[model samples]
Target: MSRGSLFQRAPIPEAKFQKTEDVTKERDADGKKRINQYVVGELLGQGTFGRVKLCHDTVTGNRYAMKVFRKQQLMRKKDFQNEGPGRGMSVTTALSKVYNEIEMMESYSCHPRCVNLVEVLEHQDSQKIYVVMTLGEVGSLLTYDECEGTYTAPVPGEWIPASSQSTQCSSRSSTSRGRSLAIPEPIAKCFIKDALEGIAHLHEHGIVHRDIKPDNFFITTQGRVLLGDFTVASKVDEHGRVRGTEGTYSFMPPECCTPTDESQEYSGHDGRAADMWALGVTVWVVLFGSLPFQKANLKELFESIAECQYRIPPDAPVSPEGLHFIQAVLVKDATNRLTAKDALAHPWVSTADFSQLPAYIEAALKVKEERAKKAAEDASVSGSSSFTGILRP
Candidate 1:
C-alpha cells in the first residue's frame, strides 16, 4: 500500500454527546436531583487512577463506558514525575495521556472498527475526570478466551503461584487465569487483519500504540473488534522517535525489552516498528493460545526473544500462509520486519478463506487438548519444566 493511501484521514462522525467544554457537575441541593443527562449504572472495571462504570444517555438511551479518574490520584502521580523516566508520573503527563487518547480516538472515529470517544466529563467539585466511550459488552479478549472453553488441562500444584506471586507477561503481571487459550487460525487471521488496519490508521497519523495486547482489543456485542486503551500511546516526533520502556512484558518488541545498564546509554526505540512487533506477538497468542517466549526464567525469556528464538509447533494446525506471515512479522531486526501496511497486504491476511473458519476452530480444539495432555505428563515428571525447544530457522 502506498504511504499516501495509508495516511488518508477519515472524518469523525456526529454523535449526540455533550462537548468537553459544556460538561460540569451540578451540586446537589436539598432533596433535589442533579441535572445530569447521563445515568451512571454498574461499576465496570477499576484502574490505577479510578474506576469505569456503565452509563446511559437519558435522551437517546445510548450506552457508554464512563471512566472516572480521581484528581487526587492524578495529582499524586504528578508529584512523583521528577524521579526518573519510569519512576514517577506528573499531572502534565496524566492530562497529556487523556487529551492524547481523545484526540487519537476522535481522529479515527469514522472507522467502524476503531474505538472512539463518545464524550468527556469533568467535575471540579469532586475533582474527577470522566471519559465516556463505546462499551465492549464482552469485556476483554482475554476474558472472552478464558470463558469460551473448559479447562481440561489439569492444574499442577507446582504451576500454582503463591498468593504474593504472579506470572509476568512482558511488562504486565497477570494471574494464571489471564493466561491465553488459542483461538482458531481463521478467526485469529480475521481479528488480526482488522487490528492491523486500526494500527495502520494510528501509524498513518504518526501515533504509536505502545501497548498492543489481546486484552486491549475489545470485542463489542455485535462482534466487531475495537482497538482500545491509549494511556501508553505516543505520537511520533519529527524524527519518528518515541522513547520509554513502557508496555506489557509479553507483548513488547525485542528492541523495547533490551535491558539497560549504567555503562550503556538508553537508546529509544522505533515506535512504529515496536507496534508491529507487539502485533506479531498478539497474533501468535490468539492463534496458538500461547506465547513464544514462555520461560519461567525472565532472563532466559528476554534472551530468547532477543534472538528471535520461538517456535510454532509443527503439530499445531497453522496453515503455511499463516506460519509464513508470523515468521515474517516476528523477525528480530525491526528494520526487516513487516509494517502494519505491509502485513495487511500479505497473502495470509488478504486471501484467507473466511468460510473454513469452523474447521480451523476444530483444529485449535485438538491442539488445545494435546497441549493440556503434554502439560499433565510433564508435571508428573521430576522437576520438569514447561519450556519447549525453540524453533530453528
Candidate 2:
C-alpha cells in the first residue's frame, strides 16, 4: 500500500516545533509556531485530559474541532515505574490510551456516520497534542436535546447551579441546535440508520465501542449523526470478547457492569453485543427524551438493565416498529441481542418512509433555528467569554 495516498499521514518533522510561554499565544507564525495554522475559537468540550476548541483551518477556511491535550498533564506516575526485568515502562506504552483512540479515529475517518479526523499535530516544545476533527457545528446529540430543554434528569431533585444553568443551556444551542425532546419517528429513524451503519463498520473491523451513548453521537449542520469518542473503544478478540468494564453507568450492558454472584455458563459477554444494548438505550432516548432504564441511583439502574425490566413508558409516543427494534437489541442475553448489521435491517429503519422523513426533518430544523436565535439573545445578555481567557487563568 502506498503511504500518504491511502491516508493523510501526519509527518513527524526532523526539526522540532517549539512554543512560547503561553501555549495559545503566537509570535508571527514565522517558522516556529505551526499552532497558528488553525485559529482556535471557543472551547467546545472538556475533560480530565484536555479541552476541545472550535477551530478554523487557515488554509481552507473550514471550521473544525481541535482537541488539545497537554502532555504534562497526561503523564502518570505508573508510566515511569518498572514492572519487571526487561519490562521497563515505555512512554509509548504509557500513552497507548491516546494513541489507540487516534488509530481508531483515523481508521474510521471515511465512514459516513463516523466523525472525520482532519489532522493530528504535535507541539513538542509545549508538550501538547492537537487533534483536528470535522467540526460538528450542531454538537453532540445530547447537547441538541439539552438545548431544547426537553431532557428530564434521571434522578428527581438533581441539583444544578443557577449561575451556570444559562451558560450550559446556551452553549448547547450554539453548536447543534436540534432539540429532540421527542424526536419525530421519521427523524429518529434517519439518525438510527446512520448510527447503525457506523456501528456495523466498527464491528466488522473487530472494534467494540464500549462507550455508546447520546453524548458520544454528534450531529452535523446537515443533521447527519456521527459516532465519536473512541477513548474507551477496544478491539475484540476472535471470540468477540473484551474485559475491564468501562463506560457510562447508565449505558453499560449488564455483563459489563458489576457481575452478579449467580454462576453462569459463560464467563464473559461479547463486546459487540454490549454495544447493541447501549444502542437500544440511545434510540429510546432519541424517541422519548430519556433513557429506558434510568433510575435514581447507579445500583437500581444496573439492576434494571440486568433484568431487562425497562419498557417504553405508556406516555412515550414511540411507534410499535420502534419499540420492536429496541426490544430486539435490549435482550438480557448478550448472545441474543441484535447486531448492528441486524439492527440496520429492522423495520423501523430499513422500512422507513423516505418521503415522510422530510416533514419531520424540516420540523427539527425549525426547532433548531428557533433555539439558536434564543440562545444568541441569552448570550448577548450574559456576556460571552473568549476561549483563550477561559483556559489561560
- Residue 183 miss distance in model 1 (angstroms): 1.2
lDDT of 1 at 120: 74
Write the residue-wise lDDT of candidate 2 on 1-393 in tens digits. 011111122232232222223335463444333355777766767754678888866798898787787676676512332222334443433256666777777554467687767777764575778877766555566542336534431111112233323332343333322322345555667878888888988877777788888777776667677888887687766667765565777788877654544443334457788898889888877767766776777778778877778866644444567778888888887777887878888888997655544444355456556665776777778898422111110
How accurate locally is residue 91 in candidate 1, as Cα lDDT from 0 to 100?
Answer: 37
Tens digit of per-residue lDDT, candidate 1, span 1-393:
112222333334554444564564553444322226777765666565566677777787888777777666665564122222344444354655666667766555545556677877764465667788877654554432335432121111122234212222223333333333355444566668778888988877777888887777865555446788887787776544577656677677787656555465544567788888888888777766667776667787787887788877645445568778889989888878888889999999987545543443344345446665787588678566442110100
Worst 10 residues of 2 by lDDT: 1-10
TM-score, structure 2 vs. true: 0.72
Number of residue pairs clashing in candidate 2, backbone atoms closer than 3 angstroms, sequence gap of 3 or more or interchain:
3
Measured on C-alpha atoms, candidate 1 has an lDDT of 0.63
Q: Give the Cα lDDT of each candidate.
A: 0.63, 0.64
Q: What is candidate 2's local distance difference test score?
A: 0.64
Report the Cα lDDT for residue 138, model 2: 58
